[model samples]
Target: MGAGRPLEVDLRRVWDAILYINKTGCQWAYLPHDFPPRTTVNYHYIKWMTTGFFARVNAEVRRRVRKKTVETRNRVRGSSTVKASRAPQNLPKNPALTVIKRSRAESIIL
Candidate 1:
């Protein structure tokens, strides 16, 4: 199944089946008929899990989540500081102020 073109199973469906089996702790033959044949699902589940697909997916997801959380925290911190700065409406703004604003905006996008 791993060579050439990949198999046709829907990843989400397979994932659901994996979750179901894990949750129920059922024998492979006992899996419901609504999913692929129990043997097919079990084989794919074992192959993927043994080959580290689940661990890779989990690590990538966690890395992205942590990065987003750090970005959000930084934005909050900068916003508070900017609020304190409160440049006067009538005065010419400092060039450093423009640079700081631009950097903060770029950081948010990242």
Candidate 2:
């Protein structure tokens, strides 16, 4: 009785619509008809983005993953961990290209 329409939009449906747009990489105008209206989903997406909701969620997820990885590593290694050397391991010991230093006296004037 209080509202004009009885909250017809479902937030979960809107979320699914947003996910569909992200997965398919399609324009808002191309959003499928199965989900809530594109305007509804787009509005929620913009609101969340502007309020830093996605950034906070991403940071929390990364923190949890890093903590779990460290815990697993410590448990498996038993406190004796080997750290990598300062130099990167991927480089070849003998490089293909070598620089030859030339002095002023060595210059051949044309």
What shift in Å separates residue 46 of candidate 2 from its native position after superposition? 1.0
Steric clash pairs (candidate 1): none
Q: Candidate 2 on 5-36: residue-level lDDT in tens? A: 66778978987888788899989999989998
Candidate 1, residue 49: lDDT: 81
TM-score of each: 0.62, 0.55
Q: Report the error of model 1 at residue 41, Å.
A: 1.3
lDDT of 1 by residue, 1-110 (tens): 45698777777777888889889997777888788777778788888989999999899999999999999999999999998789656877799999999999999999
- Summed backbone clashes in each candidate are 0, 0
Candidate with the greatest lDDT versus the true structure: 1
lDDT of 1: 0.87
CA-lDDT, candidates in order? 0.87, 0.80
